[model samples]
Target: MWDERVPVHVAGDFYDLDAFRTRPDVLRDFETAEVGDVTGRTLLHLQCHIGTDTLSWAHRGAARVVGLDFSAPAVEAARALAAGLGHGPERAAFVTGDVYDAAQSVPEASYDIVYTGLGALCWLPDIRRWAETAASLVAPGGFLYLAEFHPVTESLDDATGTRIVRDYFARDAQVWDEPGTYADPDAETVHNRSVQWQHTLGDVVSALAATGLHIEFLHEHDVSVFPRFENFEVRGGYHRFPDGHPRIPLIYSLKATKG
Candidate 1:
């Protein structure tokens, strides 16, 4: 499913590949402030789709950046984009492999920063395994950083995003065979089947803590990178509920470090 959507995402206005070529830094303001300076550091991005966010770190002065994704086409596009940005494989590399095997799949054994971007955790069924695997690649003194859509939003009504309509503690995978992609909903596509799991805030934090990664902080924000709810309006490049509406966490970021 992800393989087929790579082209759509690359060409669609959602990503705006052309504009990205000119001004490639797309890291959110809060993410940069939380992650701190990445200059001369090696960063590994897990589940990197099309490598925009991964490359954004590279653009911000990370000495080395590697992006790994399960989709072959996504990796290929990432490599091409890296080359276009004047970065060779040594400076910006991309690999095609499952994130669960990141320790073995990545070129280096570990990295100074292990990053997992938004809308990624929901795709994995075992949050514990993901934490252990991802943490294993965080070099000593390095940290694993995660920016995700808050799980609480999943339980709310899709339209109003106000009332809870689904079980928050549901453990079963949500299976769907929906048509079209998120970038271009009306786009012609075939591989639309997908499965997603829900992991609460505690589930993610506890899983990382179990791996002996000290929790630095967990920050929740009222804004989202995508228009998750019908009532969301654009604010500072993010989607937010109306000013008068009660605010709920739409996104959360975490930083966990090894001793």
Candidate 2:
């Protein structure tokens, strides 16, 4: 899924690689501030599509950063990008593997931070397994920080207009068979196989808690990286309705620490 979208995303203006490089800390002011300083920490980024956020951590003075993704092409691209930036393979590295198998691939209790960036968790089918892998990878007292799209945003019909067509708590898999890419709707594609699962706020919190990771904080933000639903207005950094809009969470960030 990510392999097909990587090139498209890199070429698309949505990622804005130039802007990211010019302003390395694009996510500095966001919810990640709760994670505090990462300098001298060993961080592991899961489902890192092209490793922009992973590279950002390296730029933030992390001692070592490893970006893991299922897409081999994306891993290669991320390594290439890191090398081009003069970081080489020492500061950062990219690996290709499934999130569930990450525990077997990465040493247990080796990382100080297990991080997953925006728009990452929805791709996983099992949140329990995901949480377990994250908890297993984190060293004692280490943290797991996830900044993801709010489950409420997934309930609306983003394809056509701002309409609540799906249940917010629905655990069923929502199949998307669209041909055009999210970045470029007009671009032709060779493969369009994509599957996503919608998880609620409770689902995320409970999953992490079940893994024996204590929750530190969970915050909901009105703003998101993209305007998910049609007819939503972009105000400041948030996408919201004009007024009298339904009260719903648009984005959420969670921080948990291992005991």
Candidate 3:
């Protein structure tokens, strides 16, 4: 499903390829601010679809960067995009592989930063395994940074776009087959079958801690990088709930150190 939606996203208004070509800082403002100073650091991006944010790190002067994704098409496109950025494999590279298998596929404890998640964690089947792999990937003295859509915000109503309809602490994965793509909602109908798990803030924090990664900070913000829900107004450069509506956090960022 992701592979099929790649072209739709690359050519859609959501990604804005033209704007990205000129302004290379494709990551959100908070993400850039939180994961500061990537210069001279070896960074690894997991589930990096199309490598926009991965190459954005390169733009910030990362010494070397590797972006791994399960989609072969996305990885292929990322390689092309990196080439266009005037950086070869030595400085930047994209690999096709499942994020859960990254520990075995890539060199462990070799990256100064292990960056992952941005509407990516829900697709993962197990947060514990994900945390363990992330901990293993981060080199000693390095850290793992995650900026993800807040599960709290998502547990609210989606189908009706009103009221909290789903369980906040549901341990099971929900199956979805929505035809419209988030990037291009009007695109041709495509098979979009997938399973997503519901993970609370505690699940995320506990997983990281169990892997021995000391949590440096966990911050939640009302701003969101994506239009994950309905009834949002763009304010302060983020899609947020309306002015009168009860303001709630839409995104959460975590910084955990590999001690």
C-alpha local distance difference test of each model: 0.95, 0.81, 0.86
Each model's TM-score? 0.99, 0.91, 0.95
48 Cα displacement, candidate 3 (Å): 0.1
In terms of lDDT, model 2 sits at 0.81
User: Quick one: best lDDT, which candidate?
Assistant: 1
The candidate that wins on TM-score is 1
Quote the lDDT for 186 in model 2. Answer: 79
User: Can you give the lDDT of residue 125 in candidate 3?
Assistant: 80
Cα lDDT tens digits, model 2, 1-259, are 5678788877778777777667655563674577778899999999888888899888888988999898999998888878877777667888888989997665334699999988888888899889888888989989899998888766678753367787877888777777767778876777877889988889989999999999999998766667676667877766675566665677788899988
Q: Candidate 2, clashing residue pairs? A: 223-238
**Number of residue pairs clashing in candidate 2, backbone atoms closer than 3 angstroms, sequence gap of 3 or more or interchain:** 1
Clashes of each: 0, 1, 0
Candidate 2 differs from the real structure by a C-alpha RMSD in angstroms, to one decimal, of: 2.3
Steric clash pairs (candidate 3): none
The residue-by-residue lDDT of candidate 3 on 56-110, one tens digit each, is 9999989999999999999988888888878899998888888888976664446
TM-score: which is higher, 2 or 3?
Answer: 3
Question: Model 3 off-target regions past 4 Å?
Answer: 107-109, 159-162
